[model samples]
Target: MDDKTRVPSEITPDQWTWNVKVDPPFHKKHFNANLVKYHDRVMGQDKLRVFVPLCGKTLDMIYLSERGHGVVGLEFSQIAIEDFFAENDLTYDSEKLDGKPFVRYAARENNITIYQGDLFDLSSEVCGDFDASWDRGSFVAINVSTRAKYGRLMSNLIKPSGKILMELYQYDLAKCTGPPHYAEEKDLVENFTEFQVRMLSEFVVVDSPPYYSGDDFQLGVALLSH
Candidate 1:
């Protein structure tokens, strides 16, 4: 997805870039382990339904399900959702809403649903309110102007006292103009006020297998509790 056309609010669907490709080629086994590590540290509980906003074919959803949490993931692109299931060798049943389709899959015997639709249209009635949110690319994908609205919608989609694990980049503005925006500490604290911010940790691990390659990007993790 190109940075400019991905802005849903500004452009019409036809004008935007819906050309989503398969996610970065990575081993599922390694991806699952990384997700499990994060879940164990941030989620801390089992059997809780997790909401993945703007999930974009991340294998983290599958990892969340394998760990016993039912996963509800939202993606605007159908190609990405299809690619995710196809690469994982998972079978799914699909449903349509006003002509748009969503796919439902079982994640290691746990229910995992991937909705290919507008995030704003997903309601409690459809996916059910989530216990916590596992946000990887969602927050940083939007511009600063839209981050607050994103946070508010996230708070509404999740149950009270919900937890949110957001991934952001800490970089100089000169280097990255970001779809993956570089968020500052103050921006996260103030924007996510509904949730009590506890840890804003910076992790600089050597490019690990499956998730990342050589030192291409520096990342930050924001763990929040609502």
Candidate 2:
């Protein structure tokens, strides 16, 4: 496959059906520190609806739901979603969307619902508007060509008063072709002009994921608000 077409979807056909090496191959078993550390600033409101895009069975959903916040997650992998519930020992009811590739999974024990399908398939009316968005790996996972579409969806889902806490990697992109693609300041400005972007902090990625170049790679934490 050409460089542009190399993406997350291409890994799936072999990953679940056969043995394939994929970056961060297993579903994450722990909470993302960016979410926990910036909790008060990003998701301070109680019972607020939070959107988690490209969520790979992240434990942050449990963290949010337990704190009385509603969590909505979008993921393309059914295997990952099922593994999440099974590994976490959570019971959920499932419903297939009519004429859609998505199957909705609602956790019976918490205020968490996950939509299993392509992230691009989501719409505000379908997933509902969110007061806050926690984008751990979502935005960076987006291919540069499709970032505009992703930004448009965020525009629709994010309320005027909503906030978005995001984590991204900053590095030399040409050398390291990535699913967790490197993002620049101009990229965000061009795609998400409706919101004000602020770089909160930067920390060295310790034990950096295999996808990264591992040469002093840094993780950037940012907050976006309308």
Candidate 3:
């Protein structure tokens, strides 16, 4: 569709389904490097455990695993977890809990494990204490109305000294209202208060994945210290 309707849900049914369907490729095409760069800087050579909230076949997991960091990815959609392994040509074993399956992919002799289930339903024990967090489009997926709840959950679950590297969409109020929801600087700093904000910068980048545009969109990357 057009730029104005690029936001999810507002887009047509086929487009919406396609968006969900091609998550793996979409992440690679659009935002993979940004994640790698951010994580590499924050996580360093510590071999620390990394958490990807609302992970949807994100290439970042592969990047982190390759760099000797352990990965724990949380996803609500089974399709997404399956697609991630399939698309990467990685094989994994599965365990079913309450009729839902959680697929585990271990790398580096079983250091990294990708867990699948409703993000809301996952426990800290399942996710483990993360040294760092990678948030690509996860936050924006929640409606603005529920963002506070999302923030509170993040605060409660995340390790106190851990860091979160997040990407946020900032829209011009007149042009768009979103699922790539608009979030301002104040909101982020306020919402993530328990953690000190280390970095927050805005850049104009292609909105790939859901927004496949050559035109620039405002993207925010913030590093949090708890």
C-alpha local distance difference test of each model? 0.66, 0.77, 0.66
- Please give, for residues 5-48, the per-residue lDDT of candidate 2 as tens digits: 33333233223331223324534668878788999877775679
**Candidate 2: global Cα-lDDT?**
0.77
Worst 10 residues of 1 by lDDT: 7-16
Stretches > 4 Å off in candidate 2: 1-23, 203-205, 211-213
lDDT, candidate 2, residue 52?
A: 88
Q: State the displacement of the C-alpha of residue 40, model 3, in Å, after optimal TM-score superposition.
A: 3.3
User: Which one wins by TM-score: 1 or 2?
Assistant: 2
The best candidate in terms of TM-score? 2
Q: Per-residue CA lDDT of candidate 3, range 134-215, in tens?
A: 8887777666555677677787677888888888766544455555676656667777767777555665565544543435
For candidate 1, list the clashing residue pairs, or say none.
none
Poorest stretch of ten by lDDT in candidate 3: 9-18
Better of 2 and 3 by TM-score: 2
Model 1 agreement with the true structure over 8-119: per-residue lDDT tens digits: 3333223324455424432233453335557777777668989988776777887787778888888876777777777777777776755434444434434778887776
Q: Model 1's lDDT to the true fold?
A: 0.66
